[model samples]
Target chain A: MASRILGRLPLDEDRLAQDMARLAQAPAPQEPYEVFTIGRWVNLNLWNASGDDGDGFFNGHRQVAGRPTRLLGGVPYIGELLTTWFNTELLTMVRARNVVEWSIVPHRDFLESGPAEDFFRVLVFLEDNEHALNSDEDMVFHMRKGEVWFLDSAQIHAGVNISSRSRWSLCLDFKAGAGFSPGDVFARAGDYDPAIRPALVERAPAPADLPDRLRALSAVVSRHNIKDIAFLLGKVHFTEEVPIGASWDWLVEITRASGDPALLDLAERARRFFVHSREVYEEFSFVPA
Target chain B: MASRILGRLPLDEDRLAQDMARLAQAPAPQEPYEVFTIGRWVNLNLWNASGDDGDGFFNGHRQVAGRPTRLLGGVPYIGELLTTWFNTELLTMVRARNVVEWSIVPHRDFLESGPAEDFFRVLVFLEDNEHALNSDEDMVFHMRKGEVWFLDSAQIHAGVNISSRSRWSLCLDFKAGAGFSPGDVFARAGDYDPAIRPALVERAPAPADLPDRLRALSAVVSRHNIKDIAFLLGKVHFTEEVPIGASWDWLVEITRASGDPALLDLAERARRFFVHSREVYEEFSFVPA
Candidate 1:
């Protein structure tokens, strides 16, 4: 399995506060895909191809990781933690995502990019948010503070933070092959103990007539509320029994019933842009171009 | 007895290289005072009132120590080191100065500002520079990598880096009364060890014709070369057995011999502005206003 608990790092509240205080001085830049999130979801570059702190996007042409940016320097403990990973050469883009009262739509990453098998992903929870939840194709889970997990991003995955507090996590992208394993990444730490495994999320069964209830959104769906409706639909997958991809299907169904061709096209395009093939800079808009 | 040895920190080359690599990407900002140095003299703020990485100058009004700036976050080990201080509340502004082919002219700091006795200055040499030399009123010494010293900025002092390599040092300003002592600052470090104390800088006696040699600079010193000549004279104190303040005196004498009324006034004004009362933001320019 690509996803499993790897190891953990020592938690230091003072160090986290220092990093948080520095980040608080400036507002986080908005990510390009606005419709993918309901509330604030900021992706800050910790290590990337250009080694520039201000650069959050990946430069596909130059896919080489350089030195840590100034942002990483300010959070020295994080920088020191990165050094502990043995196969650092396999790493590429490393970023910290801080989500506050946000819900991310279900999507498969690297669908239009490099070979999914060659990419490995890791996630470390910097803080524990009780209401935060994440799900992959098969399982939903909650990552606790300092817990490091091998996140399988190639699978359809989504996240939600219903709480007002922030959920901070470091997402590490590694370009590696079948030979690379968790052992290589956690070489400095001892072999993982089975006791640290995550508990499966207990989600409620989908209510009968759920589709009819979702279809009811068609009456209220407008050009203005279309994006919010789509995000709200995505959030349903976290609490109820439904296929992760059902969120997009519901969006498409709701918009088609609206009798607005433009609304239907927007819903379809958003699904494709977020989960299927999307041009590098392709952006989905509520208004037809 | 304002300046003395404190203690040392563990030297980590990889950590140092990590910080140096990040700093190397961007040119360090020039300090406010220009005439005091010969080459690149960058004073970067690690901690200050505003907690802004870009601000290097001290704001005398708000004399409170705030959170570490983005710059300090990038150097996490340095941040950790700062926390080791027992009396961090007493600190106001802490900065790191990097000098490359630079020499600071002899002058007393805090002369026109806060009570000199209340300000406790500490210097920690970040790297070893064989050619770097610093002088207080009576003694000149070369600080090595990781060595921490209590610097007396109230007395006449100067620094020079004759080497092409960079000399980086952390300068901390603490506000306290007679109750505060080096014991409190180094409480975590235990009692001082006499074995690690610095060696005094060896110097030759001043040349018999030193006065005439400096006075003869009147022939070559002009508006274009006056600042450079002043810095060169300041550098002389690093090599010869002359009082630290002789650099300013030599400048005044050279300008008097030049018989240029404007040049004489400029020299006197430069001396006064640096070592005496200078209204905040008052800049000394070669061009007469």
Candidate 2:
């Protein structure tokens, strides 16, 4: 499936409490400086390359010294739950992300991670955050606590947590065996719940003259607001009827109208970096000057 | 008398067309650099100190050499209209403002404009813009073409033009005589139409925990989005059930949460400037560094 709910994990309050306590004490490895984030979005790794608890940066399992996945020293509850509820041998990387009053800009993942069939991604919400939302290219959705979603990260997507409380979720990346299918993995892992369904968000239709309306931003676009405008445009896709790439197009138009060469150049580069191609550790800043 | 519609001007399409043509060719004196503006909000003067059309900056009539208002060299149509419709002897300053996809941040005006009764402010819409809105401390409203509004600029207020089309309005300031009232000026000027009533906006009540929700911005506040956040906060007061000053309080909280000393300092200064005291030509920038 491109992006759909896989199953629901059995809610274990005791285990969840323990995991929450452990995560609260865990030190965030880094403050991500990438274009995809706009707030304090932190990540804690439970399993990844080097097996170092401090190594929270994303490194594909194949690119590191460690041949396969290894459980980090800390976060025993997450490790136990993963190993018990899923086939840990097939897992490549597992991270617990915490977002509080933050947003992840619209982006696609795994551009260079080989064939799409070789990769499998799953996101599991750890708590009920009414104010959180996740948007794929097609639709905006809300995932409840204990929901296991098979996320097609290869597609354009974004996330937002607008609440004062934490929106904690687990991101797991798996490597499929030769000619692997989701059913085979589910049978082996015994984690599938066929009865569970995803909850989708309903949004009002975007105005017909949205492009013309959006061009109005050009009159106000400036260095101080380049990123905010980008974020706002990115959000319009999920909230309105516009396509994900439409935001970048609007950005280009807005910056060009600004009559500022630097902003114009930055908008063009941002369009490329965000929708076209982005390398590991490559960051884009609106005010590079 | 606080913030209400004074009357409706007779719609003269020919004069409006001619004015529009002239305004299109007229050079904008300056792009306003103040806490109140966020886009290309331009003002052209027809009457002011020095009687120079090029002198578009705002200097209260009393502050300049010309005790009363003086017609500028150019823009004879605007000067003629003001002279014919109102008592020019009592007028202090007259300006034509054009806003396209721009917004004036929520702010209180006439903080030092002497006694409230002595100063009379009127705004006349030159065209119909569906996306335009004006908000006072109490409510948001829309003014149609040829409508004349008695604006109490002393109260907290803001303006927004979300359309790509120009939102042009005439700002007329008058220095009232002793024991003055809006009735006395209208009787003297022959500009009042008693039948017109202001169309007030209907808004839902603000959420109970809006302050808590606003504080969430602190988690994501940064130099790149400080102004956007401030503007967003400013707009919220107009759109939601929050007081005008609440935006500043939220700004202060958001900046303090950012842990950025520069942003924090700017927010405090902005609070003081926009709502409290502002000297002539004083400007505020979100990203001064």
Candidate 3:
């Protein structure tokens, strides 16, 4: 799985800081929550499918439960700003406040059951501290304040806070049919003033398990998975010390045996470019001269 | 054009060095030669099509012109060593001795006319200095003593001796149908003792002219040139900031417009892998953000 930085939001830092300070001074959670084994982290649901303040079912069509009395406290500026910035039909909005030294277990959302298409989860960091969102394939995103990201919820991810002070973030879930995508956000982010634009750092994921992963993918060959599997084979050929002939042979044999013309064509292209020595040498016998 | 380090040859370095020393002490070239305006370098033809001593046609079947009178004068070790090492039917042989502070202009070999297939030119460096052979895509190979290389004659290449000491190398041409290839040599090179293996340094070629090159290739769409043109497009897409979508779009349009299904399939495979962001972003407008 690959994750990209969609871009940053343009929120006035001074006003956001003031709003956060006011929210922090509010009288605790307006509703009770269950404690977990890791630590005590509180969730304030601003909107959900059910009108109640309790943590409601997190999927399907949702409506604004009620006014954000605990944080917004009848204030209209922040709500208007969020509604305008997101520019979509809001399904659910939640303020997740993580206690110091606490972390959420890695897990995927809306996997077992969900709508036909995938939805987007946009995160707006309220306070800056040593907190990170670790996702699939060991990708870590150290989100900073005033930054916005469209997190891929299908991938297993976790939110962690190891700062001395508590951390807070606003997570907004928009309906998949809202006609918004990460690509749009990414392009829009580039339009922001350079001074306040958030930095997007993408780390190349380590391929320690690539061999095993490739083997697994090859075992279950299908049209949907063939492209990715072929790409991985090319990646392995170029970046690894594995013999080029061996890789070419494997791809040729597997794709041919699968009897998929597309895969076979892909294999041919892979041979032409990724696998060197295809053009110059017909048979590369290792006999020393 | 791309060049690969096919492999290394095994030779008795001590005996070869002794023969080189004996050859160096010899008076001068045993045959007549021509001096070019580029530099003071000289060519001594050891063998050619004609029995007379002169630089004859460099390709096709040939016989030894005469004895290597100056270097191999009464010395059988070097001749026997070369005959045994090459171990194939020879077409032509020449002793290229470059004077100090001289260079050869960049050019391709056998471009005007040649056999149906390409021939191999094996260079055995008799004396080593700070000399280099620059070839396709800015690749440079520094030939060392007792080292043999199958130079890619079809690509533009040049030899340079920047050092004050004169450089000498024996050039041997072998029939391409002799069942020897760079791939076979490259695979076998790994078995050689690491110390004797020549270093192949590849420099990144500037892609400033890539767009123009690609345009020219698209104009002359032929089966013979399609593969190379596709490979170059892949190279540009992977290594350059040119948007992958743009590349895919151009390839699809050109190959389809050319009415070549094979090229179209090749373009499809290219888009599947080399052109990233293909599946993610559909409409990649080149407009900034």
Candidate 4:
């Protein structure tokens, strides 16, 4: 299942309040910070460990599977600062494995109306909302001070001023390290079917015994070995004459890896005698570039 | 509005077919090509253009976008070939000031089960599909040996091919230069609005003259000049102090820019200055990065 690790940090509310005041009025200068600021607003988002992309709303617009820049356009106290704290804290809590080394979801995706499954989302607060937590879903908790609230992202949520007074807290979203499996986060990767036309039946048949070349091909397929599958396709000889598709299938059946795209692509590319008996000049089985 | 520019090259079916073959067989070239033999083939979807943002789908997907090996996976065909063909065939043939340059439309978001305006679309290729066109959405005109057809991606559409024999053509989702407004294309840029609980009241005296600062802000706003409006906010004195939830409205009212994010963002940030009095310091405003 998709898993997430959580933790917290001691916040300096006094410093935060003072920082907020700086945004309100120009105070006497003490010294510049590591990053000079009108305030302590740091852009927090799903960036690589390298810390390349600067924070803003535009980065979060188009959320695809892996490259999800989930948050955007928010002040630091609520997001980036919290995440930075979490990352630093995570470093100390557990020394290694399945550890999330970065990012955090302070706010989530939710709209007033939509389908049940899409009604609630873990919305990244920034551009494109790059990736959205599924609606009709919830994470274990949303971060809160004193005690932590395993926020079920399923709730329609946004950052609101719970108090006229601003609150300061740490937040984090960590990518699982070596001990973690991304696909495991969801379910194990599905048993995806290849582009086999299930409706179409292969008509090729075989004798109980195998021929030498056919045997060699047979050895190639069973192991899910792509290169060997291609090798056998060019080398094997069929006892029963079969059509193009069936001939291909029979080769794969004997080798065990026949229909896999990896093998098929190789056969189509490798400079060898095509099943059609012609020495294809165009190994890719197509015309010139 | 979104924009683009598309050009044409005489079908070097022979050359393309050849190059495609080489690339397909070359152990996953990293540039623009995706797959050559697999039934489902595609091109590039470079999620890292904005850099690696793990927050959403827009980041990167080795699956759909193709992984870069020899730098050929998801790369556009950038060479004398595309350049010469584009400039000579399309751009030169037709000239215009601004065309659809780059655009993306959230097709999945706008899909409608039933045919709808500004909704999900399905491109159903009916009986004798050969009579019209073969491109997924009539991206451009499709002219085969005998017939010609115009492409239309106005709604949710999917293709159904009942032809007995296998037909050959390329199927891909790419942004090409176009004479049409990019906004009209699939996945073109669109917009969203934030919830605003605005409190607006015409003053009791029915003031004949708005203050000079307000008038100046209004002028800058009229020109859609948010930066200048921001500049004004840095130097304005309001006769009526801004009310809560109305900070954004104040900035817009005081400026000439229209009600847009750039303007609203300025107002939202200004709210961070919600102190009872401006006693501590002066000249603190939201300085955009």
Better of 3 and 4 by TM-score: 3
Consecutive 10-residue window with the lowest summed lDDT within model 3 chain A: A280-289
How much lDDT does candidate 3 score? 0.46
lDDT per residue for candidate 3 within A63-165, as digits (tens), equals 3332343444433455656656654344355454544333443334544335424566767777677434333333455678667766666654445443335
Clashes of 4: 103
DockQ of 2: 0.02
- What TM-score does chain B get in every candidate? 0.91, 0.88, 0.53, 0.26
List the candidate 1 regions with Cα displacement exceeding 4 Å: A1-289, B60-62, B187-195
Best by TM-score: 2
- Per-residue CA lDDT of candidate 1, range B103-212, in tens? 67788777656667676788888888887889988988988888878888778888877544668888887765677666565536474443576868888898787787
Each candidate: RMSD: 25.4, 20.9, 26.4, 28.6
Residues A1-289, model 4: lDDT tens digits: 1212222234556654554443233211111110111112233233323232222222112221222232212234433343443333211111000001011212222121222232111111211111111111222122233222223332322121111122332222223334543222212133111222211112236444433334333322321123223322321121122221333444444433444565444444322222223221212211111
DockQ, each predicted model: 0.01, 0.02, 0.01, 0.02
In Å, residue B190's CA in model 3 sits off its true spot by 96
Which residue runs of candidate 3 sit more than 4 Å off their true CA positions? A27-37, A61-77, A112-116, A131-133, A177-180, A183-289, B1-289
**Candidate that beats the other on TM-score, 1 or 3, i.e. the better one:** 1
**Candidate 4 residue lDDT tens string, B1-289:** 1111121224444554554454333221111110001111222222222222111121111112212122223223322232332212111111000000001110111111212232211111111223122222212112232111112333211121112222232211222233433222222123111122211222123133434324433322421123223322321111122222232355645532434565455554443332211222222233321
Q: After best superposition, candidate 1 residue A236: deviation in angstroms?
A: 78
Ordered by lDDT, highest first, the candidates read: 1, 2, 3, 4
lDDT of 1 by residue, A97-198 (tens): 877556777987766556677767888888887778899878789988888888887787888775546678888877666776566665464744335878
